[model samples]
Target: MKKQYKRFRLRTVSAMVAMAFVANAWAVDPFTVRDIRVEGLQRVEPGTIFASLPFRIGEQYNDEKGSAAIRALFGLGLFKDVRLEVNGDVLVVIVEERPTVADVEFAGSREFDKDVLKKALREIGLTEGRPYDQSLADRAEQELKRQYINKSLYGAEIVTTVTPIERNRVNLTFTVTEGEPARIKEIRVVGNKAFSESTLRGLFDLDTGGMLSWYTKSDRYSRAKLTADMEALRSYYLSRGYLEFRIDSTQVAISPNKQDITITVNVTEGERYVVSAVRLDGNYLGKEDEFKSLVTIKPGEAYNADKVAETTKAFNDYFGNFGYAFANVEARPEIDRANNRVAFVLVAEPSRRAYVRRVNIAGNNRTRDEVIRREFRQFEASWYDADKIKRSRDRVDRLGYFKEVNIETSDVPGAPDQVDLTITIVEKPTGSLQLGAGFSSAEKLALSFSVKQENAFGTGNYLGVEVNTSKYNRTIAFSSVNPYFTPDGVSRAVDVYYRTSRPYEDQGGNYQIATAGAGLRFGIPFSELDTVFFGGALERTEIKPGTNIPAAYLAYAERFGYKSVSVPLSIGWGRDDRDSAIAPTSGRYQRVAGEVGVAGDTRYVRSNYQLQQYIPLNKQFTLAFNGELGWGKGLGGQAFPVFKHFYSGGLGSVRGFDQGTLGPKDVTGSTIGGPKKITMNAEVITPFPGAGNDRSLRMFGFIDAGNVYGENEKFRLSELRASVGVGLSWISPIGPLRIAAAHPIRKFPGDRIQRMQFQIGTSF
Candidate 1:
């Protein structure tokens, strides 16, 4: 016979006191639980229910324990309903589990990708394989809206749809309707007494829609950009001697349709004060005079906040050079209202000196740890030298393998005199495959292909292959460089190449010069910015006979045979400190190379030198100058090889002249490039009109002068070709592009003028 039983049920708790009262009313006498049973579970495991119960088998159960068991199960958030039933001395647990999310999808989302939306939802705990909840779906919708708003899409709408599927799962889809972005209609500056309103407003990056707004998108409103613009405005005034300048308030307004936005900035331009004096008041390690020399604030000049800040930063960095990592330096100003003058006091505190306890590397998932470690100058357990740390960071950044390299210092927990340096790097793809095609007057049609890996196999080695097919020139080359061939930072490079060239002429010709060579080079680092290279190559040249060939080539081929061989020894030196290799704003670069054919059918000595200097005139303008010189002479009573002569004209040299046409001419009127050359170029570069301050696209006016002289001719300044031109430079997606329109200012009777020139992947 079945045991007699009285059943009691418990549901979710509406109120704690009510649950207890009802539980007590139906409470059963304390009895040892003989068996526990769980029912109505769809997906939840039996063990899960059993573990959540307050009392186990052979334990006493009552109203108090039963209430706790219900609360514990509900806290798991996996159940839609939970119930507890009692039969005699047995406890029955039942649960209806919540449905899990099967998949997440998006529809009509043009502003953002579906994967981005899915990741956003995942961050908020509302993703696939998780229990579905209405509250979490609501939060995900809000998050989607926030992302759209950041892009100036104020009218974006989101609809979340939950479709139930089989096996207690649901699929979620978010449908988005993204409207047009709100544009900045106007920007106004108020309460500006010292400067004109237009001048002050011009300082901000955000502006009314301009002609190039479609490209720049500067007209779009962004709160973060506005905050930065406000800071820039403040800095401008402070740097210009407005010592008490401040931003009073800022107001942003939107149209009723939410299609246009307006921003107004109110500023206070207080009295401009002159600097009365600057005094240093702190311990200087008995080097007060040395520290005093670092001060840049002039006593009689205007009170410029930039100079004050610079002085204080110098003091702090100077202190850090001595291992004081936590140095504090502050510039306090004493204002004299009546005299309209100010005095600055620089206060410094040298904190405890610390040594690097450990040097940790992180975030270089692809590059080897040793690749980054070898570039570091600051070592573990060494004195914390800020200069060395900065140099280490710079060296790693110059490797071009990582998009970002950052170093952070943190104090050790237990040791006061020890710190940890964590170098974090964001690795970027160092390999590139490029395919390009171009059409020109001389080359007609040209195609180029290249494959390069700057950090090959994470080994900090360089590997490259390049192929070019053009009408006048064709080349195929393979190269590899081991940047750290030895432990002492010497670099080794190997190159194998084949090239063919033909003289440019109106009438086509099959006559060509073919060259094949191999070379090995080693670079020795003389300093951080200087490298010396020495190399040797075995080259063979073959002069193919055909029509319209230059007389010089025929003469050389007849005397030295159709084929000639040379073993040339080369030495070079290079120093580059440009801020940017592609779009340099400031710095200088210099290179000198010389080659001597020591043994072979041809014997010659050739040398070339180049210098480039970029001077930044202001924030938006740069003045650049370039100069080059070349000279070559025959050795061992042999004439210089005609194929080794220098050419100067067109895009890279003197614009407005035909390519390789600004040199000596042979009897056939074909331009035979000479053994001596000189070129000079100067440019004033500025931002493109309506492009704001974008450096990637700029316009420049340039003056070019160059000429090539024969081997026996004297160098004459009067014979130098000169041209003036205006050009546009763009760092395009494919490469750097330049287009110039020029007029010859100094030209000879026989000069071949092109008037316009353009090219890609070339720098002057």
Candidate 2:
């Protein structure tokens, strides 16, 4: 009976205690506030805290209002903690403010630049002077890790340290350990039936390390490069008639140490297809036969996706010629599964013709808008023609002021038939300062330099100055060109130069020539691919007597005087259709120029014609041929001037022979004036081995033949010297670089040979 009574008493006490606790937790009483006070703020003002409170100085305060004020104040992200204290007729608010970020620093960051990392962090709301939070620091570390991973730096580690500085601030220091980039150890291509594994892997830019891995960097594992390689592999098969080919899966695996990687690509190669027939199914605007002529796909040939794509593009371009800016051309293949043959039907939809509403030039931050706009052939409010638009883009690109140029057409709102053409360009530095030095056994140490500005002061005018300090060759030259000298794109160039050519380094030559000249040239556009040039120059030549002057030079000086003044006139015609000035793939260029000394002590006529053709055999191979013919004749029974002679043999003429050493030599072992010259070059060009698809660097095997004929000698094939060699060409940062190793196939007894030659800055 006593134990039961004690249990009943304990239960009653527990119930009473629980009821008191519930009332204290959920119950609140309404009160009227007389005043409000805020404390514990370093930078934030008291008014800011007061405004954040739900209840004002004289407003009524209740449990809901108190909860709202607390919530609102915390949402500002300014305070680390907040508290509320109530005294009789007074409300006190106390808060702990979050520290501001004082400074952000980076250490051991080699892969990514410090400014780059800071900028990225700033984008994620982690800049200095902002409120610092631990969660934000964690997020920043993760973000940096993600960036490193994209660069294939799997072993990279980021450690963020936060240190409290003076005046309620903290400094963030991100210490990074970026290890070596992951390398591609293996690449396995599975289920390729038509092509061998090695052949398929050859199409990829990412591969196992090779002998030239340091240069090509193909051994590195890059996600972006891998994606591009996959696309190339697909194109290779698609262009080779495997229309149904598909990549089933791709797996990229990293080793435990994060230093090695392997890629596995599984693909299904379907049956090869042949083109049974090709039909055009669109209104070619009364030019069906013309469009048909543009088709490169033959009916009896194998199905080539490239040919089909080309045909479709040709149809679209043809439609665009008729003012169809929104042309839709598609090649729909009709597959015959049983016979393994495909028939392609080209369908075109030429929507309403569009007139250009506006021609906009964008991304010309450094260049003037007029500079880019003047290159446009398609005008505002004119009919849209694809060919003209393409030409405009190419013209702007050819200016060499931009790294990239793109054109986009947008349909004007509420005007379905009108479109706005926007030309976008990425500007590059047009000013160049080149300083170079070279050494050779014969030429000794030579120093050369030039300062050039293609777009001087954003005016699209070229200015250049060159100086050579070589012991054998000393020159000073100044040149300028104004491309917009005339409204019709006629260019004008002015040049002034002083040159002294000596035959001996010790200044022991019997004779030396000093020339001071100035010329003005103008280029008149005759057509899209042709130009006519006219120029005149006045030159003063002084022959300095020395020890071992050639007999011919002495005789001429005696008859014409040591000092002679000549007025030369020049006229020329040129055409250029090559794709790139630095690396031409397919096109033909021809030029013919003639110069005559009409009013001077020396009277002569000199003419030269040059032709170049580049033929693309495939994406990887090219055949280039160059031929030149030069002739000179003296007027009024005088011999051709010694300095005006044409000499061959060198890097620019015939390799394997010494420079200007291929003509007839006098008794003093010096090459004299020549009346006739002929030179020819044939090259089989290919992409550099292991550099895969890099057009900037290429390799070629060349055959060169050239010879100079003296005044009495006639042009003959037997007199021509020949050479065969392998060479390399690279478009370097400053200019084009070429190197050649040659062997003379046909040479005379006294022919001087220079088997290895290199040039730093010159065009192909």
Candidate 3:
């Protein structure tokens, strides 16, 4: 009987579908809707039917009106079938309402969340509580397929099943079969005569799977990546003097099983061209010579599109500084095929100056508006200065509370000379809890932890605590910083710390130097790239007696009665122009710090200076150089305190040597440090193999030279120790990791060699 009922239901549904199609052509003589009635509605309201009819109670109805009403009802997408009928002076609307979607379910969907799919379906009118149509179901299926294609899942399949439930509702189930993502089988470049195909392919991010494929994921095929790779290829050729180079075509094909993809790019390598002349053509505002000086392209040099673009951008920025926010700059190239050379004319059009009507902030869902507004150097109602605007944007970005920051200027309505600037920001987490570990031949196994909030409670204040647990060195510290402590952008910071250090771990029985201190500091901004620092600290140092104590430390402990108190005053200056603090490509950073012990058990003066410069050789290569120097002397004819010494070696100083092991040693063969330190490092950095131009993962070859000298020891080249190494730097989920395998270029009999060294979450 159940089987027979199911067959009957199928037959009835088939007949109803046929009738609906046939009704499209059927017409009825309509009359006034004196008392319209509706049937076959389970969820739809009666008024809905009344509102859909074209004829009112007192209006005359005709055959055309009856047909039009039927079409209008169907257009609502709420009914599977709509019909209009008349009985004497009355009209009736019969509607077989579509089922409402009660719930949506997913199975075997790992590529995306079920809610994501439901949200996408909701956009197309197929969500729960809404009418369900078969056409809408088909569109949802296509949307799912599109999403899968973007993930390289070419073999993915989706089956949507609709099952009728109680109360004229249905349950939708979308079963997904997500196969393996398509991998790049091969990348071929055709008609590249100047460069080898392998070399060109090497420039692409997408490639066949390799040993590191699981980590880098560069083997996957993506249309967006392919497009970017093509652009890079074009840029490469243009920058290398192929000014007329053109891409012929590109073809990407998938395998029969959809598990592999191949890409072929065809290009025409035009003849290399050199620059014949460069000239400024438009009004230079009486600064034609100044504008000409900004030109980087020179005659007799290879025609570089990058340099041309840079020169134009410089012109635009220069104009912007003078309130010409809408300046137009163009580089017009005149190619001479006969001589294989090109001439460029720079044209500029400085549009009318405009004042900023308003400065709007957006997308700061967590951070307060004041936090962002305070960083702006450009004010509302002020003439637009491009340099100041750019600086303001960078300042907000440097706050590090946002993942992305962008600014757009739009013309204000009815004000030809007024514009509004909208600053949009995408906020990221401003808090982090880091747990790190490190292993060094000298320090051995060390564990460190830190909890910091850069924007505390969204108030734009920094608070942090840190602890380090190593047998040779242990420390606990607390710190706080307020960047806007002073209305003029001066920053205030407070720090308190306790540290215990064992100078020697190899032959040590816990002979240690301990210190406890607190400090307050202020940073005064001198310019966009410079800052001056002033601070004072009160510290106390204590020495604990133990076996195998270094002679220098023992003598100091005896002379100072095992403890000493000091008041130190510090002054410092710094300048930074790096593009990024984490992964700088080009810029210079420098610092000079000095401290004097004014009134204390130990009176001395210390000064330190450091300089770092990064030069970008090209898009993928950089050269970095760093140098550091330190010196200390005792005042009032007292000896320099042993606890206030400097040590060198290990990752930051000399990678091949053990940590703090390149300095003077005591009689018991323990490193006692020294009063003078010098270190210099040079590195050639490049993108990691198979990682394309990713800066977060890089590899570098470095040369290091450094040593620590005693107070009476004079600086000498012969005393410098050096090493050479290859290293890798990865910005991992937890923190930055650095590993190096180094070899010492200079060594002594007692020098400690530690070739493999690594650390996490700390700078070198």
Candidate 4:
């Protein structure tokens, strides 16, 4: 019976095909020589239909041409049904146009914005004003669901509604039911014998919901995150002498409700092997000694994958420094099962030398090409030196005008010894409007605002205006800097400022000091990380007399008059190599500055030196230290200017004392800043609780010791005030913020202590 039915089905298909051929032959004959007419087009133009027709007016038409015309019109995606008819010799082309999408809307979607959903649909050809089909609507629903799945919304449901409107148009509404996102309920690590399960799980960023899970989202299950976590797990073992460590399998299981997930990582921690021997086995360009020095793998120590990888990378980079762009360096291991040891053979291959054919820059929509090109150390038509290319990339990154910078090397076609360098950069907004406020014990409320353009007009210049209003101090300043002033890496800067300072405690005495100055400076690049600066400034200071003025200020006014003018020469040197300017993990920074009052009413010299160092202890901890020293002395038989003294005991110095209130005092019991200053700070920083390894949010414990001394007083350890505190540092949207609550370990009589303080734009 089955065989008979199959024969009948084949006969039916053949009969249908024969009928179609006969009907096509009858409908279209070989005659044409007349005009054509189109029917059933509302939005699409008649010319569009005529353009797609295979046969034109006054042309012979046949059955093959009629079939081709129907196919061509349908291929345009504008028509749903196309028919060709013949009335005598006048050809009639009829089409039913697809509905035009009038609008796209979303409802009941909280995980994504309406515009975001629209954009996602548009990428898949389902936007408004385009032809609509049932298949397209079905695809839009699947795409929306996929987007939600990425957000861990496994139970999300999308229902597409197609509403027919007037003029053969339709409205597409994607109503989304975004259910609760799936949370990670547990993480299990199997086959880790040397470490506890909890310890192994702690290495992963995905965790069972923590108290702060809402912000970190670490409790969400993500395939990408799970992959990264597995890599970390493998690295941890390999770095600790488990030479044959590997991840066997990773299983992510979702609950029946799709609201909870469990992740299990199975790993194999093989035998721990020690290094037995290391040998060089390949061509080293007759510089074996030089290449051997770059090996970081210890012969007698436990086998470390990190050290092995470092050695190989160093060899490759060294080879690239000599124009060998295609150098291959590999470390092959020989395992000794009985002795539990491994031997490494370093193999090196330096391919043909290459020169840069062209250096291309891209993605700088606003910045000029020259602005980025000038920073490159590796130029076109030069030998490809990897070191120089790396330096060039770093230089452009330090410009602070780009959010991302990448360099790619590609071989030029048909050229064996030539390559092209493409430097792609993602530019960021260089203009900023900053509004800051800080609260401290002494300076109760302080407000600051600044407008700055780091890359003004894409000329690699800086222009800024700053204003500060505090109860004890007020300032307004304007500054401009040209980084390429003379084209030899020389920088020129100009500054104009006005400032007023008063005592923290008013006490009905409005005695104040007003100063105004303007300066021009030039910086000469001594090296890649060092700069020397020299400048001259003209300044005027006026001391307004009132009740309860400090005796030192009164004496200075009596000696040099109430108003004084000075022209000071300034010289400074700075060097910074920190990994990050905002959140440093490792590096050192130093600065030395001095001012000499060569021709002024105040004939004194002042100098200051500061050093900061950041040491990364591990993946999650950093140790930082900062120290500053300042000194001023009378010169030409004149006392140091009272207004030029250094002040300590603030957010940037000792934290447990009031701002600028840890120094000598006047007879009226007001804090008077001194000419000598010393500050030392040390902190241990770690990730904030439940934040995983995010460095932007962190907590720290700090120890601060510093003091200010009168010019006549000697530097003594007993006079140094010390404090221990815990602080929070966050790279917030506004700026870097720090909050500290400290307890002074040592305090003297009449010392003003402020235990809690918070401020912006400070790091310690």
> Quick one: best lDDT, which candidate?
1
Taking every candidate in turn, the Cα RMSD to the unseen true structure, in Å, is 3.2, 7.5, 5.4, 5.5
lDDT of 3 at 628: 95
lDDT of each: 0.89, 0.84, 0.86, 0.88
Question: TM-score winner among the candidates?
Answer: 4
lDDT tens digits, residue span 1-764, model 2:
12111001111224334434433454345667888877788999888898888778777876566656766877788877776666655677888889999999999998888899999899888989999989889989998998888877899999999999888999999999999989889999999988999988888878897776777778888778989999988899998889899999999999999999999999998999999998888766777789889999898777787888888888888788778988898888999999999998888778789999999888988899988888888999889999999989988988999999999999999999899999999999999888988654335577889999999998899999999866556789999999889999899999999998754223246357889999999999877778899899999999888777776677778988889889989999999989877799999999999999999888999999999999999778999999999999988887788778887877788988876688877776776648799999999999788777678888999999999998788889998899999999988775677888999999999888989987665443
Total backbone clashes of candidate 4, pairs 3 or more residues apart or in separate chains: 0
Alpha-carbon error at 557 in model 1, in Å? Answer: 2.1
Choose 1 or 2, whichever is better by lDDT.
Answer: 1
Whose TM-score is higher: candidate 1's or candidate 3's? Answer: 1
Clashing pairs for model 1 are none
Q: Which lDDT tens digits does candidate 4 get at residues 1-764?
A: 11111001111224335445644445544775487988898999998998888877899987667666766777788877666667667777777889999999999999888888889999999888999989889988999998899889999998888899999999988888898999998889988899999888878888897777887888988788888888888888998889988888998999999999988888888899999999998889999999999999998899999999999999999998999999999899999989999999999989889999999999999898988998899989999999999999999999999999999999999999999999999999999998988765566688999999999998989999999988788999999999999878899999999999975563557788999999999999998899999999999999999887888789889988999999999999999999998999999999999999888788889999999999999888999999999999979888889989888886899998887788888786877788899999999999888988778889999999999999899888899999999999999887898999999998898888889988777877
- TM-score of each model, in listed order: 0.91, 0.86, 0.86, 0.92
- Which residue pairs clash in candidate 4? none
